[model samples]
Target: MSRGTRAPRAVRAAAVALALAAGTVVAAPPAGACACGGLVDGPAYDTSVSSETAVLQWDGTTQTVLLELDALSNAPEVGLILPTPAPAEVALADPEVFRELDALTAPRAVVSDHRWWPELGFGSGSDGAGGAAGVAVLGEVRLGPLDVTTLGASDAGSLGAWLTERGFQLPETIQTALAPYVQDGWSFVAARLAPEEAATFDGTLQPLRVTFPSSSLVYPMRMSAVADDTQSTRTYVLADHRVDRVDPTAEAYEPTVRFAGRVDPATVESAELAALLRAGGFVTSHEQVFTEPGTEIVSDFVFAPAAADVAYTPTYSVVADRRIGPFFAGPVLAFAGVLALAVLVIWSGRRRRAPAPTLAPRPAGA
Candidate 1:
């Protein structure tokens, strides 16, 4: 796609007035890839996504997804789109939920004497033509600075056109990417920050919570193929058993398990978060990088219970102190003592021999 001319400052408001479309949940910086799927306006600006995180909690019949993204853009506003299997309820999610999950499933710190440090969506139908085009505007709500709309479309073309009509620049590549989801009859949640609020939008955005019904655990990813760069997606799944990603096509591409173990709901401060984990189960974390999302990812991530409920936690060895003081003190001290003893023995042997020879000589003289 051609990198269009930089949007003029005067046009910023007009651009913001257009739909800042969004879908699904997950995050990255403006330079990085977006999780789930979304498109950003003002490609002329240095824009990308970073630090994308998604927390999915499934309790058999219902699923709640919390999404957060660190978006970097000079544009007046960015657009994000999310696709769900069913109509979804969108609201502002507690940022603390992600913090708590980070703390919960974070790599277990193993101290080994030495220390190393490391470190959406949618609905729509405001336009009268929307209903006729097989696109249903299921609902719309405003949360904080976000205008969220939920929409259902019978085909990808209609969905793409709908977003384009509202000012989202949907490239042909992105339109093709949306085909599968639309074919599967998925609903979308489109969101954008209000123009006034987005003008001063710092990269840090409030997380969003989307609740919907699903028979199985899943994270929408098909729409991410529109990303121009590779995207790193980290997802935390809270379920009754240890869960893992299942490639419907059995492709080699799959996310590595970062953590899979049970957690206590009481430890969580958010009542909503705790309630999701109230049934006492495991929280599995997965990290996947879509280097070529357009080709590498052909399906949304569908998770299921692992064959074995083994627990896995990523760990790193940390040296408590880099100083050799304690680690080598004992060995160094012992070596020094042995060296001293050896020197003493050699000196005593040489001095005694000399003395014996002198005594013999004196006796001979007498």
Candidate 2:
């Protein structure tokens, strides 16, 4: 139940207190409005050679989102398209918990280290200004020069038209492949540009690619803030789970663990414990059995490393059925000791009785 994104209680409380601390004051609306919600209307720039870039900064008081169009080899008509504020999605390490900082103006403040330029909408299209029929929605709003070819209500089509009209070209092969998804996936699609070559005023757009693990892998989604820093970074890792080797009870069990701090998985040593179990005729596999402190390990006998730095106290449940044999040497030696004692006592009593019998014969002869 706690697996989803949850905001820290203290963080949520502070956010509420901060909101209450600020007195409610309404400000005037932004300068000019565009059909795609809130649009910034300005002179059209001939950005044929450079890429378009928008930089947004949000302080406690105001949010400033700046758009820069680079005039490179082929310039297209560029516009900042803002839809009526849709719900913003913020990813958290734990999805179940909702944090308040994310709910507020944080989206307006993309971290400097992780700075990114998102796609804004178009200037007035085919029928001039205020035409609800054609509005450009540039999908992948990254470093690359967007090629807008369609002018319609949807941001994707309009952005495409804007790019094509200006001299930007889309490969027929890629266009054909994306034709089916033009309606749905286009909104989530944007081209990636090289990070090192990206600039605020350059028309040359860079391409970016991100890879995520498949669902079957057990991975950790971690988020933490550095000292004296306002931004937090979230990272995901695919690590093999292991049990505590010293504790025989936990040898075969593996559980996913979360640490308040960072842990280096490369230095972990549970391979030896797995080897020991194999020696005892047990097979081991890396499958998550529980959401506990240690890594998940499945085996016949207990499996864990001899020395491990345990991050949390864990409870292990093991159901073991073993056969005990009568040939055990300790019990056999104990039974032999008792039998020798009985034989010694019988011999002492017999010697005492035999002497009495001889004495009785002597008395009769006398």
Candidate 3:
């Protein structure tokens, strides 16, 4: 999804014309590692996916996936190919849902005063598818500025050829990457921005929600191996209990849990998002960088409930002040007090050795 593949010349020309007519300025794609659920093709502008975020909510029988992509492109048209285990119902997700979740899970900041008699020091830290023989078009719908198409294919080759025929420009590596999903009998979801929508795209794409029947909580990621470089992914999962990432292939790499706890229903502003959270009170946030997707990510990310539903909140401490009033604390204060005592003792010793300032002073007084 982050890799940039050029569209056919015809598609490019059409996109250019659209941009010109819309009075939109066309620019070269910005540089960044691209990551996507499937393959990405841009008509007039080069596209790169910088990062991806997904929120997965699973009940016992169904799963709802909401995804947002941060990408840069000047194309008047952009397309994405996503593979899923079952047919999906695709629609626009409230972008505010992500914002609300972020606010809810953000790391708690703890500030402490470092009274440095001198002070204390501290540290802290912190799809779609279709086409070709054996490819069947399942459904298509338009939501806002997006055109979404769902397709099923018997094999990966047919699916790849079909997309290429439709100007997706699939590379051999990407085609190879699709084999496993096809072999598993998965369906594909293809989404594209309408010309009007693409013209208005700024680096951020509107979030999309896909709901389908799934027995296990999963985030499709195998196809992401086609990305040109490392990919960074952030995933939020809502379930009955805390969940941990499981790589079916048993790879050594796994996403780190950033936050895990039960979310209060009142904090969720979106009625739709809130309903999903109500089914599963706990949320687990995970983050990982796929350094070598080709080898490291041999399978999609699967998640299972952890043994315990323990809550986790990442917190850090900050020193607010080094001095309180005119007194220093900590090591500095101890050292100053010791020095002051030492000087007093030395002065007392010298006075005692001076023979009481001599009798001369007494004679003068007499």
On TM-score, the leading prediction is 1
Q: Candidate 1, residues 102-129: lDDT per residue as tens digits?
A: 8887788788774322212466412222
The predicted structure with the larger lDDT, 1 or 3, is 1
Q: Is candidate 2 or candidate 3 better by TM-score?
A: 3
**Residue-wise C-alpha lDDT for candidate 2, range 28-83, written one tens digit per residue:** 11212111111121133221111212211122222222222222112122222221
The lDDT of model 1 is 0.63
- Candidate number that wins on TM-score, 1 or 3: 1
Report the error of model 1 at residue 127, Å: 9.3
- CA-only RMSD, every prediction: 9.5, 26.2, 9.7
Count: clashes, candidate 2: 60
| Candidate topping lDDT | 1
lDDT of 3 at 365: 50
| Evaluation by TM-score, superior candidate among 1 and 2 | 1
Instruction: Give stretches of model 3 more than 4 Å off.
Output: 1-36, 42-45, 74-76, 112-131, 196-205, 249-251, 322-366
After the best TM-score superposition of candidate 3, give how far the Cα of residue 113 lies from its true spot, in angstroms: 4.3
